[model samples]
Target chain A: MSKTPLPDDKAMLDDIAAIVEKTGCERKNLIPVLQNIQDRFLYLSEDAIKILSGHFGLSSCEIYGVATFYNQFRFNPPGKHQVKICLGTACHVKGGDIILENFERKLKIKTGHTTEDREFSIDKVACIGCCALAPAVVIDEKTHAHMTPTKIEGIFLGYEIEKEMKIREEKKRDDKDTPA
Target chain B: MMIIISVDDKEIQAEEGTSLLKVCLDNGIYIPNLCYMEGMETPPSSCRLCFVDIDGEKNPVPSCSVKVREGMKVFTNTPRVRGLQWSAFELIMSNHRIDCGSCLSRKACPLIKISRHLKIRLKPFRVGHINSGNEDIVEDHPCLIYDITKCVRCGKCLHICEKIHGRLYLTFAGRGVDMGISFFGDSDDETIPCARCLACVKICPVSALLSYERYEHSPEGSSS
Candidate 1:
């Protein structure tokens, strides 16, 4: 059966419309659905907001305000390796600042910024709830505690060497495959 | 009926509609999660600590609520997921007080530990008022203290009070900057007739909620 071809933008709008429609136009569920979209789309694009507002019968600014209000939600595409330094009460008192500085100097990136390589992105967190050790940082999902500037450097070097070694191995294989 | 999914390169079998959070835990892939208290009827996605990346999805979604599908690929420790989780973690931290050395929930808290693991940074965003030490302290209940300064407003206390304790004794009263746990007048006793269930105590992601005897019980470990 021949199917009617809808434009890419319209199809995406339709999908978003369907999601909003499924929520029954309730304001309460707006955030959750937006979250789902953000989850699927990285950042909440203006197009998605327009589609959502149109579907929910709300203003685009209202959607933007709600989107910006929650920290879990974001409006921009983030960098590659997101580094989080714990600045929670316990962590803050326990030299969380030093750890954050270590990241800034080593990665050559400031908080809320992605590295030039786009390989690392850094951020500060309130608390991940492991106050036992205080002054902690999380790289991806691995929690490192009682961090020191020296240890942070060693940790980065370890990842760097591992990454470099992998690249080298790939290069060696490529050379072997070349026609002599 | 079952779908094959990969986590950090290892494949696991999961039911059609199983959540990615459950899948990781079931397969012994411990993805750090603070808000995922087991057996809660409601899925509280309040804490974004459990964010993870899926292959087709653009951004990382909370593993606690997102379902796993057939042939799905996921990465829990990706730079993207870690960055967003850290951002969310910072949002929670900016409102919290910085007195972990003296705080009651020093060792047992998971949020602090996870933040350490992720190397979470706190650049401080303006959120709620920091305790100035001049405002009248509100310790209505003898068993617990509601220090607004220490709270991240994770809603753990509010949810526990309503869900486990029945009546909503502790509502997050006021608007954004002024939000805090407030209770209607119970009696002259200055304490709600809470069952002392300790659900709030357990669910508190930070040291905001504290029990009176918690420190006394652990004399040696009560450094904070």
Candidate 2:
């Protein structure tokens, strides 16, 4: 992928304007409209939120408050692979704590934290409802249930495979550029 | 135009262009689902539990999000699909609070009802440092209570606030593990419109959001 950023603010703002019109600019309709916009754009940009606030005749804080109140709205960029650990009742009772601890130690990030490489973001979720298989964790939407601290290394290695391959490819390019 | 769609080994004809989810429900072909309210467009495909395998796709896609195309082969219930769905279900249930006995939507919550119907007999995972307790629940103001522990990040609450209120108030603050709802501009009572619209409460599939003065236990609910 090129180092260039995706799109400019103007394009993003225009896209938000389209959502505002389609949502009918009703007071109650703001959240869905924003959600739709966010679905298109990974996160809600400040410009988009400002446009929505102006169209809805609400303050930016009001707009931002609702956006920040739900788990689906993302203010920051997401990782390539998202890892979520269930910490609900059954899982918690069955050593879900140990699993989460393992992830934190291995990823060097706690729940609600993302690795600097942007490869992974680890989160703690409530019940995924697979209680019979307590202490489960989901990586990139693939669930790994009944996990033990021992199994975490394997899981991390699975993700690390892709990460390391990418690093090696980049290093090869740099080596070719060295002076003779 | 009527089109035929296959669920497992059975083939059924349905009106053209209806959502696979609606067709399945009409035919009594229960393709597992959550975050999809029959009447609401929140399509809330956000939950990812409605995923079903179509013939050629690499990954199982959410049935609720895709429209049924002609001659499309759909696999509703399968060993692999069930496992994937079950895994997703476990993820949501683990992160969600289990005080359903006292929740208002305990009887009506889709997640709870669907789990019983699926006869999900296993508890594969559990919670860690993020304790599930009353103290962890957020009673931030008079209008609502946000129990972060019970949330599934379905975007249903986000839709309700934006769709009905014309104001983008609260939203998911971070990505991945740090992903949870947060307040904007000091999420305080004075700042909140306190509309008490109950959109967030009504849309939540779990007990993440609740009314301020709810009392009494939840009534009997459906396992269907």
Candidate 3:
């Protein structure tokens, strides 16, 4: 069986150090430090957490405990695209849970897990502040309103085709750049 | 200084600035709570079980987060308060492993006691069970054994760990529904730094954390 690769600790530490510098490396700046690190890495890595613990004079457990108290922080690496299904009151009444289950089935990954190919990840958010557009699904910051289980396949296909076209265009650009 | 508050039409004197939940609990008044960590300055109020109706307030407020005030009128058994508490208790039990019949701590488990007090039957809710199949049991430590499935994320263990040890070796990892308490570092030989004070195990409310020896000697045939 192939072994899982370890994250580049040196690069991650550098990014964490930059965040700590920006956030002032204080115990009280824990949330901001975690937020900035997550913004840079899409999730809080073990190495980043260790660096924060050292900088803040807190144990790794302390940092991890505080981070887990909130729903915003993530520990695993996120995917290229984040798929968020709104589970707000309006959305729930409009069958948002069904839409979420369909996405989970289609992606073959549960909520809060990245796909094996790192193409997408799913999350059930409390709300996107758009109750008027009940049953909303947000993909990479783009919102799709009035979503249904049947519309999931079309959305997946659209992203797949878009990704294929982008790959082809990049290949063409590389060919033009190379010497004939 | 002492403050007077009326709870269920009974006038009670409590220490000023103390949490209403603490006053109610200390005075033999039952207000169900799962996340009220003792000596915590700011309560998380995540459990939503200690909700109480206050005079002039339209909605029931969480008693653990609110400090007592002089001459405040509080109602603990109002229909709205009971309804909200019951819903919160049911929500907490929804994801919990309800195998009390075979649990090692069946006699003294706080989850069982609190649920019994709240009159919450172990029935399934519409939210469904979160059978994630991620019940990883950690038995590396000679003294402690952590069962990930039974955890309710009360934060009591972490708080008491820091309170007693002045440093935390255990922590909650991950976020959202997948969050679970875990030990730091990868070394099996790290020799679980806990002082064996049993602070975390005693503070755990649920039977998630148990003494390894106690678990071994407990009744057999129980699912982990």
- lDDT of all the models against the reference? 0.71, 0.72, 0.80
True contacts kept of each: 0.00, 0.31, 0.61
Considering chain A alone, report the TM-score of candidate 1 relative to the true chain A: 0.70
Is 1 or 2 the stronger prediction by DockQ? 2
> Could you tell me every candidate's TM-score relative to the true structure?
0.48, 0.52, 0.65
TM-score computed on alpha carbons, candidate 2? 0.52
The count of residue-pair clashes in candidate 1 stands at 36
Clashing residue pairs, candidate 3? none
lDDT of 3 by residue, A31-63 (tens): 977888888877987767777888888887778
Best-to-worst order by lDDT is 3, 2, 1
Backbone clashes per model, in order? 36, 78, 0
Residues A108-146, model 2: lDDT tens digits = 976656788878887778998788888888888788978
Best by DockQ: 3
Q: State how far residue B150 of model 1 sits from its true place (Å).
A: 1.9
Chain A vs. native, model 3, TM-score: 0.78
Q: What would the per-residue lDDT of candidate 3 be over residues B36-151, giving only the tens digit for each residue?
A: 97677999898888899999888999999999999999998888988887787777776687777667777767676766776767554655677544545777555678877778
Alpha-carbon interface RMSD for all candidates, in angstroms: 13.4, 5.5, 2.5
Name the docking class for model 1: incorrect
